[model samples]
Target: MADYKSGDTASWDFEQVRRSQSNSPARRSQSGGSGRRTQDSQPPANRRRRKKRHFNVVTYILFVLVTSAILAGVGWLLINDLCAFNKEDITATIEVTADDTIGSIADKLHDAGLIEYKWFFRLFATVADAKDKIGTGTYELSTEMDYRALIVGMHNSSGNLNSDTVRVTIPEGYTVSQIIKLLAENGVNTEENLLEAAKTATFDYDYIDNNSEDISRLEGYLFPDTYDFYLNEKASSALNRLIKNFNSKLDEEKLAQAEARGYDLQDIITIASLIEKETDGTDQANIASVIYNRLEGPGDKGGTYGMLQIDASLLYALPDHTGPITNEDKQVDSKYNLYKYAGLPPTPIANPGLASIEAALDPADTNYYYYALGKDGKHHFSSTLAEHNAFLNSGDYAG
Candidate 1:
């Protein structure tokens, strides 16, 4: 308390100040606290908080990794299942009856190895809204189709392309009887039954009656062409199909053309049939001109001749004629014999094609009255009897 010197009074008391600071509450909180710790106690709290935060972060990271792995595993399993079900094999001949139900068709598909499970196919069809979309008919299935492909094929019309068949080609000149024989030879139908059906076949009398009365049968009107028939088709059906095709080819225009040419429809067909038998090449128009010239030109007398004198007509009249023509065939006796008759035969001898029919109506412009085939199969025409005789005497004459 006494002022000794200014320097002495200003000097610090280290020991006393330290003792007082130790007793202060604020000092205790900053340093080592009392029985209720200060910074030391806060250190324990902070360490506990940091430990909790680290545990939470680690747990969350581990949970996210585990979830990602589980999701990847599920996705891979789903993809594998889909790929396995996409490829399947099928095989068999399925005959779907007209009254077959969807359930029955599904069962057939299962039996044919086209579907792995019937319920699956049924469900798929139902889901696609195609339960009643399937058609009823014979179906051919193979083993290389999958579920989707098989379903599509079942609804596709072209899937029925494969089937058993018998082919018969009726030539352009064959009669109904001959057509029946050809069908029989090809195992398409019984010859007797086919002939019977053909005889009763309905025809357009308007076309046939326009020509002549000699063609009482359907020989020339029956069109000739190749036909494809199923194994299950009946003889009557085949005959009807041919007749229908023939009718389709004979339109009113062709008939009109014949009429315009100063010939009846039947007469054109008759002449066309003759031309078809006389000539093998495409020179039917020329042959038809020759025929008309002979009919109008001078013959043995000054008057017009009445006979056509066609060899094909004579051959058609032969009895028991089974093969090629012979020299004796020209001498056969029948109303169809052109050598004996002065005009065209009663009807067409054979069914003529459209080309021959057109040629008969529109003949070529020529003055030739006679013609004969040469050794090279070319025809030699003559305007008079003397020239025709010379051609007949040539080395090309088959007679």
Candidate 2:
């Protein structure tokens, strides 16, 4: 090393030294020299990434515009279907099957010209929560109905052709003759045809076959229930429906239960008819117990003399007898007169429901021999005629 004096000058190619250091690879990399590339200059990885990004941005904008257009078109179509576009005065019938979905039903209505569009109907039904409420039937529709009206009409069963089908409710304890009149009143086939069918129509049931006497064979066999039948239906077919219902209700299990109680199906039905006439559904067992007790003898809460003085039996002889009984009424020469006969009547007086039949099959474990109607519209039961008379005269009963 040499110490520099004042005003001394030394030169050793300083610009060449700087140029060599700047040209090095490490310096070139840090300073980004002329040979270094910009983002656009590189055509391998970064350029591909930039191209991909641009393509993605353009594709996203295009996708959004296409989706928006599609949604708008669908919304317009739905609104058009829901509104009344072409109101025409026309009627159409659409048959809806059991397997028909709301969409299929809408298609049917649209094809029938009752509805404007199927898609709109499906959406409306879904929004109204009535998709599953649509019924299977032949519907009578008019094109005059609006969208909501059309949907509601389809959901209602009465809007269908099956509305002509009447609901015939045969109340319990109605006699065959009474039921005949009721059937006629409700636009069922004539009373004469119904009675003839009851007498002659052959039912394919074991219970019916066992006691197939032509006269009054269907007395206790017609199971009283609410039945749906086409208006003016065939008498035989209607009677067959009741007989089938009866056979179904009194299946093998019920028959075996009756047998276990030491009674056949006929005996149960006969007693059930009596109980049905004597009291309401609630007092069936009590009335049934009284009937059984009267049949069992004196020591068993019965009369030593075998006679069931049931007043309803007296009225059974007269088809339309009403109000209080007379002494003359009790002397009717019919075999159904309980005052003149021993044990049960030849057949039931009226059709009995399942509950009465059940009670007859399984009577309550009571020793009651008599029952009378009271002012409270309930049966006042007693073990003897004396107590029965006391209740009758004590003014506690309507009679």
Q: Which candidate is the best by TM-score?
A: 2
Per-prediction TM-score: 0.54, 0.56
Quote the positional error of residue 248 for candidate 2 in Å: 1.6
lDDT at 225 for candidate 2? Answer: 95
Instruction: Give the residue spans of candidate 2 off by over 4 A.
Output: 1-163, 209-215, 299-304
lDDT of 1 by residue, 269-331 (tens): 788889988886668998898777666556652222756777787777763577766667656
lDDT of 2: 0.75
Name the 10 consecutive residues with the lowest summed lDDT in model 1. Answer: 155-164
> Can you write out model 2's per-residue Cα lDDT over 1-399, one digit (the tens) per residue?
999754444234566677688668976676466776665546587778999999999999999999999999887766655765556777888787657788888888888877666776888888875543455567677867777777656553422345356789999988877788888788666787777777777766666753454636777878899988655555766777777788777756866877886778787889999988887558999988878877765644434365778887778788689878888888888888888787889888888999898888778988677788888888888877688778989978886
